[model samples]
Target: MVYTICYALIFLAEILISLFYFENKFERKASKKFLIISLPTAYTILYFARLFNITVVNMLAFFVCNFFLLRLCYKAKIKSAIFHCSILLVFNVTTEFVVMLFSAAILGTELLACLDNSVNLIFQSTISKLLYFSSMYILSKVSSNERRKESPATSLMLFLLPISSTLIIYAILYSLAEYELGQVFLTLLLIGIVVLLFSNIAVFWVYEFTLKTQSRNMELEYEKQKLKSAAEYYDLLNEQNENSKIVMHDIKRHLNAIKSIAKDKAVTEYIDDFIEDFSINKSVDYCNNPMANSIVNRYKSFCDKFGVKMNIDIRSADFSFMSEPDITALLDNLLENAVEAAQNTENGFIDFSAFVRKNKYLSIQLTNSVKNIVAVKNNRIASSKKSDAIHGTGLKSIKRVVKKYDGEINMKFNEDDMTFTSNIVFEIRR
Candidate 1:
C-alpha cells in the first residue's frame, strides 16, 4: 500500500510537470474532466506493469502513455509530442537516480534496503520531487518566452545532462556495491554530481539568454530594413509625382505643339502616346498620410506589372496617432504579402480596404487569392519561401508594430476558395 501510494504521488508529479511543459508549447484541448480521467488511467497501466515485474514494459508503457496523453490533450505535431515526452522521461529518470543514490549514501545502507522501507521510499520520492520541481521552476524563470525552436548546441547539451547524470549515478552505485569506497571518495563524488547538476542549469540559462539576444537583434535589423524600404518607396513616389507635375505644367504647350504638327501623323501619334503614358492620374493618394499612400501605390504598380488586379478602398483620416515608420512598416508588409500571394494564382487579385469605425478604431483588411495556403503555428503564419529567415521577418516586424500600439491582428485562410485574409484593428487614441 505504501509503495502504491508513493508511486501514485510520483506519477502525479510527472503528469503535472508534463502539463506545464505542454502548456508552454501548445494550446490545451483537454478539460478538467479529461485530466481527472486520464491521470488514473495512466497510473493504472504503470501499476500493472510494476505488478508483473516487467522493467522494460514499465518504461515503454510510461512513455507511450504520456506521449498519447500529450497528443490527445494538446495541439502539437508528432515530432513535438515525442520531444516533450522524451524530455520529461529523462528528467524523471535522472532525478530518481540522483535522489536514490544520495538517500542510500546518507542512510548508510544498500540502495535495495532503502527502497524496502516505506519511510525511506517516501523520503526519497519527496526529495526527487523537490529537485525536479526546483529545476523546472528555475528553467521557467530563465526561459519565460516561447521558444519556437532550440539551437543545435543547446539541444546537444540538454541531451548530455541526462546521460551524464545517469553515468554518475551508475558509478556511485557500482563503487558502493562492488568495493569499499572511502567516505572521502563518496563525498567527493556526491559533490561532483551536485556541481554537474548546477552547471547544467547554468548553461541552460546562458543559452536561453543568448537566444533572446539574437532574436532581439534580428528584429532590430528587420526594422531597419523596413524603414529603408519605406524611405525608398516614399522617395520613388515623390519623384514620380514631381515628374507628373512637370508634365502637367507644360501640358498646354505640348498639346499646342501636337496640334501644329498634326499634318505629320507620326509626330502627332508619338506626342499623344507620350501624354497617355505620363498621365498624372496614375498617381494615387489613398489616405491623408503621404507614406501610407506611397506604400499602397507602390504595391499597386507591382500588382499591375504581374497581371494581378488590385482593388483598394482607403478613407481619408487623421493617422497622426501612429508614427510614420510604424504606419509604413504595417502597410508595406500587408500589401507585399497580398501581392506576392496573388501573383501566383491564375486569376490573381487583391482586395484591400481601410476605414475608421466609430471614430475610435482603425480597421484594415487585405484579402488575396492564393494558389497554396501556408500553415500557421502559434497564431503566426509560417513563411513558405526558401529563405525562411529573410522572408519571415516581415510578419514579425508587423507584429511588433501592432503590439506597440496595443492593436489586434487576425489571419485566416480558406482552402476551398484558395484565399488568404488579414484583418488588423487599432484603437485610435485621440
Candidate 2:
C-alpha cells in the first residue's frame, strides 16, 4: 500500500506539471472530473510496468504515457506534443539521475545500491522531485510570459537539445550504474551534471532573450515603414485632390462640350453614363484627419484592385489624441490585414467603422469576409500565410499600438457568416 500510494502521488504530480506547462495550449474536451480521476490513475498503472526493469518498458511508460495523456487532454500538433513530452521526460529523468549519482557518491556505494538503501532512496527521491518541480515551474512561467513564433529550423534546433541531453544522460547513467565509484571519478561526475544542467538553462535564456530583442527591432522598423508609407500616401492624395479641384472648376464647360460633340444616340448615352460614374464614384474623403484619410484611401484603392468592397463610416470619429505615426501604424496594419483576407472571397467586403461612445470612448469595428476557417493556437489567431513569423509580427505591431494607448482589442471569427471581426475600444483622451 505504501509503494502504491507513492507511485500514485508521483504520477499525479507529473500529470499536474504537464497541465501547468500547457495551460494555454490545452483545449479541454474531456470533463474535469473525468480527467481528474483517470489521468493519474492511468499513468500510475502504466508506470508500474517499469517495475519489470526493461528499458523499453521504462521508455514507453515515461515518454509515451506523457505524450498520450497530453494528446488526450489537449488539441495540439503532433510535433508540438512530442516536443513537450520530450522536455518533460528529459528533465525528470536527468534530474533523477543527477540526484542518484550525488547520493551514491556521498554514501560510497554503487548506483543501484543507493536505491536499495531506504534512507538514500527517500533522500534522493525528495530532492529530485523538488528539483524537477522547481525547474519545470520556472520554465513554464518564463515561456508563458512571452509568445514567440519559432521558425521550423529554430524549433528543430531547440528540440535537438532535449533529445541530445536525454541520450547523453542515459548513456552516462548506464556507464556508471554497474561500476563502483572512486572519490575522484565521482567528483568529476558531479561536475559534469552541474555543467550539463547550467548549460541547458543558459541556452534557453539566451535564445528567449535574442528572439524577444529581434522581434522588438522588427516592430520598430515596421513602425518606421508605416510612417514613411503614410507620408507618401498622403502626398499622393494631396496631388489627386488638387487635380480633382481643377477638373471640377471647369466641369460645366467640359459637360457642354461633351453634350455638343455626341451626335449619335449611342455616343450620347455612353457619355452620359461616363459622366454619372465620375459623379458617383469620385474620391471619398473618409475623415477630416489627413493621415487617417490617407491610410483609409490607400487600402480602398487596394480593395478596388482586388474587387473587394470597402465601407467606411468614421467621419464623426475623433483621433486627435493619437500621434500621426501611431494612427498610421494602427489603421494601416488592421486594414491591410482586412483587405488581404477579404480579397480571396467571391464577393469580398470589409466593413470598417469608428465612433465616439458616451463621449469618453472611441469604438472601432472591422469585419471582413473570410473564405476559410481561422485557426487559433496558443490563444492567438494562427497565420495562414507560409511566413508565420512575418504574419505574427504584423499582429504584434497592432498590439503594440493598442498597448500604447492602454486600449483593448478583441478578434473573433464567425463561422456561420464566414467573417472575421476585430473590435477595439480606446478611451478618449481629448
Candidate 3:
C-alpha cells in the first residue's frame, strides 16, 4: 500500500509537468479528476513493462511501437503513419539512451533509490514525478509552445501516446530478458535504451518538418484563393470607373479642339463647356502618401470616368503613429470600401479626410454612399443589399491594425444620406 501510494505521487508529478508545459505551455493546472484517471492509466502501462523483466528487445519494440501508438492517437492511419513514425522512432530511441545515461549519472543511484524507496513510497513517487517532469521538460525534443494555431485538445494525445508506447515497448523487452542469460539481458537493455533515445530525436526532426510543410501548404492555398477572388472582383468593381476615365480622356481632346477652333469672343462657349464639365465633379486630395496616393489615384481615375464625384482630403503628419507600410494598408482598405460603397449608388460620391486633431490624434474618415449596413456577427457590419463576406475581412483587417496601436474605430450608416462612414483615431505612442 505504501509503495503504491508513493509511486502514485511520482506519477502525479510527471503528469502534472507534462500537462502544464504541454497544455498551456506556461503553467501546469492540475485537475484532480484528470490526474485521478490519467496517473493509474499511465502507471498501469509502466507496470506491465516492468513485470516482463527483460530490457533489451523490449526497448527496441518500445521505440517503434510507441511511434505508431502516437500516430494512432493523432488520427493518423497505420500505413501512412508508419513512414513518418519510422524516422521519428529511430531518432527518439537514440536520444532516450543519451538522456537515460545522463539522468542516471546526474541523479546518482542513491538519489534514484531514495525516490524509489520502499518505506516512504509517496515521497519516492513524488520525487520520481519531479525527475520525470524535469527530464521531459529539459530533454524531450518537443516544445508545446512552439506549435501555434494547433488545436490544444490534440496536444494531450500527442504527449501521452509516446509515453504509453515507451512503456509497452520496455515491458516486452523486460519480459523477454527475464528468461535470457544475465549478460544478454544487460546488453539488450543498454542497446534498447540507446535505440529509444535516437528514435525520439529522429521523430522530433520529422515532426518539425511535417509541421512546417503543412503550414507552408496552407499558406500557398490561401494565396491561390486570394488571387482568384481578386481576379473575379477586379473587373466588377472597376469596370464602370475604367469607362469614365476613357470618356474624360476623350473630353480633354474635345475641349482642346474647341479652344483652337474659336477666337477670344466665341471662346466663351468653350470656357462654359469646360466649366460645366469641371463643375460636375470635385475631387479632394489630402496628404501625399505615395502608396495611398497611388491607390486613390487608381480609383479616382475610375470614378471620374463613371461620373462619381470623389473628394479626398488626405494628410498624415504622425509618422510615429504608424509605419509607412501600415499607413498604406489602412488607406488601401478604407478607400477600397469607400469606392465600393459609392460605386454601387445612382449618384455616387466618396468623401475622405484625415488630419491631426486637437488632442494630438490622427483622425482618418471616409464616407461613401450606401443604402443599409446591418450587424451580423457581433459588431461586424454586414452589407444591407449585397451579402459579400470578403468586404467584412477588409474592414476587420483595418480594425486589427487599429487595435495593435491601441486605437479606436467607429463605423455607422446614415439612412438619410445613404452613406457609410468610418472614423479612426490613432493615439500615437510618444
Per-residue C-alpha lDDT of model 3 across residues 1-430, encoded as one tens digit per residue: 4344434433333333433323322222345575455545654564455446466544544444444333423333466456544543344344444444543454354323433434322322222333344345443335443444655665455556346545544454335434544655644544444344334434544554576689767755654464355444444444544565567668777877777777786686756667476732333333554344455666788778778889877665354557644555566667777776677678989887777777578887778886455444334564444632127556655776798888888877676666777788887676
Compared with the true structure, the alpha-carbon lDDT of candidate 3 equals: 0.53
lDDT of 1 by residue, 1-430 (tens): 5345555555555556555556555667789799778877876776676566565776787688889888888777899789767877777778778888776786567776755654445445555755675566446545545544556665665656645564555556555556766757755554454445445445555665576688788778867986887777787777778787787868958686766868988878877787777656576788778777778888999999999999988864546799877887788878877787788789899999989888889988888888775675555665455211114667877888899999998877777888877788999988
Deviation (Å) of 270 in candidate 3: 3.9
Off by over 4 Å in 3: 1-261, 264-268, 271-284, 287-291, 297-323, 337-353, 365-423, 428-430
For each candidate, the alpha-carbon lDDT, in order, equals 0.70, 0.70, 0.53
Sorted on TM-score, best first, the list reads: 1, 2, 3
- State TM-scores per candidate: 0.63, 0.57, 0.38
| Model 2 TM-score, 2 decimals | 0.57
Top TM-score prediction, candidate number = 1
lDDT of 2 at 101: 80
**Candidate 1 CA-lDDT value:** 0.70
Give the per-residue Cα lDDT of candidate 1 at 130.
Answer: 51
